[model samples]
Target: MQSPIHETTELEELEEFVINFRMRRLKLGFSQTDVGSVVGKLYGKALSQPTISRFEVLNLSYYKMCYLQTLLQKWLEETEDSLKHSSDLTGFYPFTTYQPIERGRLSQRSFTRAFMHNPKPTSEEFGYLAERLGMEKKVVRIWFYNR
Candidate 1:
C-alpha cells in the first residue's frame, strides 16, 4: 500500500492539474475530441480522445504525464490569451487537425519480433517501428519504456 506522504507528492499535484484542466475544458465548452483536435493544431502531435481521457484519469506513465502536462499548460495559456484578446473563440479555430492513421493495440506478432530483435531500440529504430506500425514514435517509445 502507498503511504500518506505519497499522496501529497508531485503525482498528486499532477492529478490536481488534470482535474482543473478538465474543469476548464468543460467550462470553455470543449469536449475531449475538441481538445484533441486543437492540441494537434497547437502542438505538432495530435492526441486521440482516448489519450486525453487516460490523461485525465492518470492512467498514463509518469513520463507521459509530465510531457502531456507541459503541452496542456502551454495550450491553456494560449487559449486563455485568445479568450482575453478576442470577442469570440473563432480565432483559435484549428486550420488543420490531425487524426491518427491507425487506432488500436499493436500487433503482438510484430511487437514480439521487434522486441526480440532489440529490447531497447534507439531513437531511429523507434521512428522506424512507429512508421511500420502506424503509431507515433513517442507512443512506441513509451510502450517500450513501460515494458
Candidate 2:
C-alpha cells in the first residue's frame, strides 16, 4: 500500500545515504574492509569488503541499505569522537590495515545439511553456524528462513 511517489523519494534518500557513506568512509581513511571489520566488532555479524563496496555503489536492497546506513552512521560518530579526544590517529590506523577472514560461498551440500538439521535454528545455533561458516549470523538465519 505505497505510492510511486513515496517509493521514488525513498530511493533518492537511499542514494544520498550511499554518497555520504562513501565520502565519510574515505575521509576517515578507512577502507571498505576496515569498515566491515569495525562493523563486525560493533555488531555481532561481519560484512565483507565486497558487501561494503556494494553498499557504496547502491547495489543492495532497500532493507539492507537502511540497515547498513544505521550501522555506518554510528561507526562514523564514534570515529569522530575518538579523533577529537585522541592526540594522535595512530591507534585508528591498525583497523585500516587489519584484514578480515575470507569466506567463500557455502556449498549446496552444506546448505542442505544445515537446512535438514534444523529449519529454524535457535539464536545459539545460528551463531554457531555463522562462526563455522565464516558468515554473518543474519545471513545464516535468513538462509534457514528461506529454505
Candidate 3:
C-alpha cells in the first residue's frame, strides 16, 4: 500500500496538470464545450461540458484525471504541431467547431427535417447526429421518442 504522503503528492501534481491543461486549452481558443467535443471524438467517449468543467476544477477521481491529462497532453501536442505547420490556423484541428452550439438549443428546421426523415433513428445514427449537431445522444433520442 502507498503512503498517504505519496497519494497527496500525486493529487497535487494532478491539480497542477489540470490548471495547466485549462490554461493551454484557453490559449488555443477552445471553450470547455469545444474541448469536451474534440476530446470525446478523439477518445470515442462523449464528454460533456460539465464533465470538462469538473476535470478543470479537480473534482474528478485520480484515475479519471490521469486519463484526461493523457488525452489533453496528446491534443495539445497535436495542436502545437498544427500551429507550427499550418499557415491558415483558422481550421487547423479536425474537430474544431467554428460555431459551437449550446446545449438543448437545436434549430426547429433541423429538428423538423430529421424528424420527417425518421422519427426513431438508430443508436448509430443518433450518435452521429448528436455529435454533428453538438447535442447529446440522449437528447436526440428523447426528441425522436417524444415526436
Candidate 4:
C-alpha cells in the first residue's frame, strides 16, 4: 500500500486524505450506517452515529481515525499525525545544565542596592521567597531577615 500521508501542515493534504478515505469506502460499497456501527464499536455507543458524523464533518483528527480504522478497515495513521503535533522535542531532549557561579553574578554593593529597593520584607515574605527558591526560610532569612 502507498504511504497514508503525502504532506504535513497542508490543508490540501488533509482534505485529500479525507476525500480519498471516503471515496475508497464508497468503492467498497459501505454505507453511513455501516460506518456508524464500527464507530459505535470503536468509540463506544456513547459517541453514537450522529457524534461520529459530526466528528467526520469537523475533520477532528482523533475521532476521524477512530471512526475510520473500525469503520473502513484502515489502520488509521492517527499515531503518526498525532506525533507530528506533539510537543517540541527540546522538552524531551536533555541539555547541558548550567549553574550560576559563586560570588554571585553581581557585587555585594549591587546586591544590597537592589535588595534595599523592596520594602522591608516580613517573615511571611521571606517564607514565600524561600519557597519559591526551593530553600529553607533560614537560608533566605539571613538575606532579608535581619530587618
lDDT of 2 by residue, 1-147 (tens): 899999999889879878988887787667787678778876777789999999998888889988988888888887788789884544754433232222233344566798888777789998887766545689878888887
Indicate the worst ten consecutive residues by lDDT in candidate 3: 95-104
Please, what is the TM-score per model? 0.59, 0.58, 0.62, 0.30
Each prediction's Cα RMSD? Answer: 12.3, 11.1, 5.2, 20.9
Report the C-alpha lDDT of model 4 over 1-147, residue by residue, as the tens digit: 434453334446455666666665454343444445433444464344554455456546754654444543432343223336773322221221111222233334433653677657678876665554434468666766454
Residue pairs that clash (backbone atoms under 3 angstroms), model 1: none
lDDT of 3: 0.76
Lowest summed lDDT window (length 10), candidate 2: 95-104
lDDT tens readout by residue for model 3, 1-114 = 999999999988888888888888877667788777676776777678898999999888888888888888887787778878984444664443334234334445677788
Give candidate 2's error at residue 61 in angstroms.
1.2
Instruction: Select the stronger candidate by lDDT from 3 and 4.
Output: 3
CA deviation > 4 Å runs, candidate 2: 87-147
Q: How far out, in Å, is residue 42 in model 4?
A: 6.2
| C-alpha RMSD of candidate 4 | 20.9
Q: Quantify all predictions' global Cα lDDT against the true fold.
A: 0.78, 0.75, 0.76, 0.47
Ranking 2 against 4 by TM-score, winner: 2
Candidate 2: clashing pairs of residues: none
What lDDT would candidate 4 get against the real structure? 0.47
Q: Tell me model 2's lDDT, rounded to 2 decimals.
A: 0.75
Candidate 3, residue 42: Cα displacement in angstroms equals 2.0
